[model samples]
Target: MHLVDIHDEFTHFMANMTCLSVMSVRYSSRCILAKKLRDCDRYTNIINYFELMYCDLKVRNESKEIGVLCLFVLIYFLFFCVVFICINEYYLPALKIAAIRLKLNEYLAGVLLVGVANSTSDFMLNFSAVRSGSPTMNLAMSNALTSICVMGGTIYVIMPFKINSASVFRDFLFVIFLLQLIRFFIQTDSPTYWVKGLIILLIYPIYLAVNIIDFLLMRYNIRKLRREIEILRYKRSSPMLDKKLYDKVTTLKDLEVDDDFKILRMKTRYGIFRAGVFVTPKPLVEPRKVDVESNRVLFHNKNNPKNRFLFTEFIQDLNPIDPEHWMFSGKYGRAALICVSPAMFLLRLAIPMVNYEQIKHGWSKLLNCIQIITNPFLVAILLETAYFTTHNNSWLINIYFDKALWSLAVTVPLSLIVFVDTRTDIPPPYHKLFSIFTIVTVVTLIWICSWEMEVIISIIGSVFNQSSNYMTVTFNAFSNAVPDMIAYIQLSKNGYGKMAFGGIVGGIVFDITINLGAQFARSNSESRHLLGDFGETIYIFLLLTVFSTSWMCLVLDFNARRSGGIFLWCLYVMFFIYVTLIEANVIHDFTADTVIEVKD
Candidate 1:
């Protein structure tokens, strides 16, 4: 053979060998992958099963069909009713029972549990979003604030009743304060003091007390007016009297009488007389005058310098302590308390939970066994604060807002949520009832919660994927907010309008403080970074919230006109524009892309 022909034949042989090697490697890799899949078949099967289940359980049977869509629409309504009834019957009662078992006072428990339940949906969504590697911290926080705004708008639009109660303002102020306080805490890189968390926790009890007191005061005033009306009618029945006699008897009604007092006589020439109203023939005992010159004991002489002073008796009465001694001594408990109470308060506020219960007993043992398990980090925070404050240069009380000490402020509460057994220490009968109740609540809540989110992501997400802002408004907003809306409507219907309003405020507060707090703890650094990036957007929403709430209160002074609702609706529109154009930064400006590009 010729040398050129031999070289060409050798080249073709090499190419064929290379192709064979490639085929062998590819087949070998496929065999390995198949072996691995067979070994992890359980996980694959589980995932596949859940996928099938989800597809089967969708609310919409066919997304494109009109008739199917109508059928699903009706089914959605039915589903909503079932969930509502489940919540009303099972969920609330379960919470109430759990709270009672937990020994939380009625109003406090109501605020905590009801607020938690209403905002649970938001918490779950935020958790899943972050865990799924989505940028959701800003979305989560803004969604919470926006929920408050939506709630206020809905209240105005539907209820149209004046919230003319001190309780309403009080709740609003408290929520505002809480939001601001949390914002301040998160601003600093310094470690937060667990004591500050304790202080925030303390606000709930005080809030509950204030609500109860306001309710009692309102009821008392109503009862008192009714009594006065009844008495006035009897007064009118009396025969016409001389103006002097009428004045005398009018003054008689003003007498501060105890329950011992009784109406002995009515409408005689002598006029009305009740026991203890008039003191008859009692000998007067005038206060002894101090002898300033002699510096000795004195008697009932009004001419003495101390006695002659214009407001001498008033001054004596006004003395917070024992005026007789003019010092802290016996009978000076009130004075001592007044003087030292603030110091004591500061002490409690700074004390660590470690110092609280080394050995938990009785009620604390029963309810807050979880709470007693103190985190070392929290104790260190308390100690740091104590040391810093007690040092000679301790004028940095204001630094509490600006600086942080080491803290398990979030961790401790998060643990309580996970580990604290609600059924712990209950007796047999109640324990069984609680178990059954809790199981039902858990199951029902789980089912509804999953369904709601699934519907939103699948149905609403598919529809509005092009515009995230639309998805938020049309579905995300309504899905999370509907629970609160239902709560408000039911509360109003049941004549607990103030409480209904309070529930909304309470729900927002709970979500922000406890629910959001826990999520932040779990993903603290990421949350902080996200907040830093999106702080402005959050503040804008917050400002809108303040304005909306203030406007609602102002408009409430008049009728809650449809105009007010329209204004709120406009405000929400502005909010969406701000979120989309400014915060989300989907659009650079108002002008068209072409115009912006030309300008550039």
Candidate 2:
């Protein structure tokens, strides 16, 4: 009985151990499945994240592209608007005047029309140049050249008729000769400081007065002419009279009623019989509706007076008719004319005074004080004088003598006046510094005239053979004749006048005098032999020297005190380097081409 019970216990223990092993295996399988599931979930999540990121990137790129396209469209639209405005404001008015006057021949008229059209662009360019603060000399020279090329070239190209060379020469030569002589005289004289100051102060006022007077006279004449036309329209005149008379009457009425028209009329006494009248109007025309299918107005018959009456005209004539009912009649026109004249006069006068006052104070007085202080006219005169005096020897010597005579004549009186006018507000140090700087600059400019002449002459000699050089000299002289009369515009918004002038002078001196002089001087020396053997090395050395000098100057000036000093310096340097590099590359390429040709 005992042995059987022990066997039963052993069997039961073995079964329990087997069952525990099976349970362990099942738990291990479950753990493995859970681990696999977790890994799969993580991988799925990562994939989804990547897909979302890609979608977002695509959306962002599309949005950026749309923004750029929209910007381009806006810019294009603005450009068109500007072009249309230019045409309407300037070109159309001039063209209509030319057409009416019949002064220009058919070909000439076309040329004049084109020129008038281009004048808007020219005006904008001039304005832009003035804003840029380019020295007067640069502005005048550039404009003169551009105008000559544009006008002369266009005429030559478009006109069927050949230019009468003899006539052209006769017409232009005397004027050119006189201008050159005057320029020569002006350049030699040392202008009294006081005289210069007075002239500078008075110039804008004189210009304003003259312009205002001219405008008033024009307005008056236009008004008178319009009155005469209105009177004629009211007169019981038969259509059998002059067709011009009938048209003039209608045109007068049209001018008054038309929203597009802003006419100015002036009347002059041409004895008791009739009055001399002048009329002018704005250039734009209002839009009109028409039947697209028939290519005509959707109104009554053309011959009917009712159909002929414009909508604007009908609205304007809605008031009860009176014998004295002149369109723009009574005191309205006179009052408008009077009001505008005084306002304009006062503005013109006050602006210059304000500018001078600001200058008397410090730049802190006004953020844009420098721009105001350096007037366009003053800048132009100074620059033109500098360029002509430097480039043309005869002119320089003449101007020097003239300046000396003027100085002696005006100096004492002018100085006395300035002294009397001297204010207590001016600080002693500032006054002293300003006077000294002015004196030094003037003296330096006068002295540099001779040096500039020599350098310019040398450059001419080096660049061309004798005849070509002579021609070039003549061309340059003719091109620069009317220094004072030509308009000087600014080229940049920042006041970079000093730097621009300095750079120009430096470039001219270095290229014409230093480089050429060095080459000529070294031609017979041992350095010449070395240079001949290693020409590229010499060129490289010269280039590097220029680069270093220019860089150093830029660095020094970059830190120097002036308006927009550092920023202007950096801009100029970057522009100069970029231009120089481009030019150098072009020259190098050309030289390479020539060398290859020679070898071949």
Candidate 3:
């Protein structure tokens, strides 16, 4: 009994000592934390709290609202990401198909189609703004100028490519000249007559003519290159153009060269963070062969990232929108679709599906026969007692039936798109016409998605107490530019540098002339102005941005370089500073006419 009692007492003593040690360590840790907090200011305290989530800011739930911001940001990213996909995936594929089918130069097609499609959101936004009887078009004009500037700067900064296409600067020059032309029209106090707007709108045909001529010139060069390569092939007796031969043929080195003509071959230079933001030194792109005869790109491997944008890699993570995808996709694709199907159903309401080349759509006569009931879009737009009776035991068919007449209008033409598409089978030549509908539908989706995204962005900007003009210039412009920006950059990276440049500049031109013309043509009044005294400043900056880029390209002999990227970014910085000064009232150049400036 004595031995047991002695053991118990020793154990109790050890427990008490352990508890005292724990208390001492806790007290010292608290003291150290308190000292750190005392040494920090509010800004530092906030940083410390975020940097170390466990740290206290000496304030009560100051940034608890940050979660709200985060939620909104996540929502914004989702919508924004959708916009990105529509541009690159749906709209862009359509453009490519149209370009190839029409045999138009990629650069010209991008300038006309991608440019107009990309600017559709801004056009719609500004159109509605002006249609609302608001004569001020500061929001529209700011969006156009800021978008062009940011898009141009962002393209080169991300992926600089050689400006190889002939007369690429013509697009930029047209943009600048047309922009100034519109400025001259509304720069005065006279009512912006519909006649003047109509005149400005007439410039679009000339823009078309210039691009058509450029396309013809480029085609002549490409054809000449092909003929020369053919003649050289007869000498070399090479049946097909392989990688090494292509390098020689396109480059025209170590062989009889024609000094009169030149071909600017694509040279892809991957950025430091191009491969998943890691310093991976793996071969950036595999060598692929292009047959001038076939005009088809044959890849050495399936994983080649040639002609694909950076974000295209992440597309596999998203779900397919077609019902066939849900029915036929692998377990993973179906699972992804399942996760987003609810949102997709609503999103796909007015959006039509157009099948592309490799996956040409073929209407199964069986499916097309009963497509009235089988096709989701057709079923959505139509309903009958027979359908209810047939599917009554299986599922609720009424749930799929749409009562809206507009849905009928949308789905009627869309019903033809329900085709069984595969990679091996080729689609009909007539199917290329659907690219127009695809481009229009994708643009519509982008507009609706972006408009909602901007609503969320504007709310986010309001947290900083940002004014309407600031939101339009910074956030609204970004919303309009983002999908186009990423898409064009990806295209440029893929050696469509001239095409990308055309899309960027040509879109800006369309905005200034077509969109703005529509606004004034509708209102028949002077358009609303920019930030107090900042109207003329932004126009001047846009001109500078274009002029600077053009000068750099000409000086470099049309070689796209990192220095060009850096220079464009510097110009953007200067633009930002000037705009900020105006916003902050550091420089007030408001004249009598611009006093009643309209913010979005």
- The prediction achieving the highest lDDT against the true structure is 3
Ranking by TM-score: 3, 1, 2
Cα lDDT of model 1 by residue, 1-600, tens digit: 599898898766643331112112332242233222221121111111112222233222234324433544554555455455445433443454455455443333445566656666555545432123223434445555655566655544443343543445666687777667666655555454454455555666666667666545544554665566556655635455345445544544432111011111112122112223222111123223222223211222434443233244323322333444445355566565466444333322222111101111111112222322332332344334422322111111211212232235664665465334432222112232423323233333433444434343333343333344344433455565655666554443332333345556677666666544554455444434434333455556666676676666665573343456456667667766765564356644332333444553
RMSD of each: 25.5, 33.3, 19.5
Q: Which candidate leads in TM-score?
A: 3
TM-score of each: 0.46, 0.23, 0.62
Give the per-residue lDDT digits (tens) of candidate 2, residues 132-155.
Answer: 212222222223322232222222
**Cα shift from native, residue 387, model 2 (Å):** 31
- What are the lDDT scores of the predictions, listed in order? 0.43, 0.29, 0.53
Model 1 lDDT, residue 243, Cα: 50
Off by over 4 Å in 1: 1-81, 87-116, 120-144, 192-206, 209-447, 450-455, 458-474, 493-496, 520-523, 526-535, 558-562, 582-600
Model 3, span 39-149: residue lDDT tens: 211112101221122223222232743564576577677777667656655566567656656665655666777788787766665533212322234554566565555
Worst 10 residues of 1 by lDDT: 354-363
Off by over 4 Å in 2: 1-81, 84-99, 102-132, 164-167, 170-189, 192-303, 307-600
Worst 10 residues of 2 by lDDT: 484-493
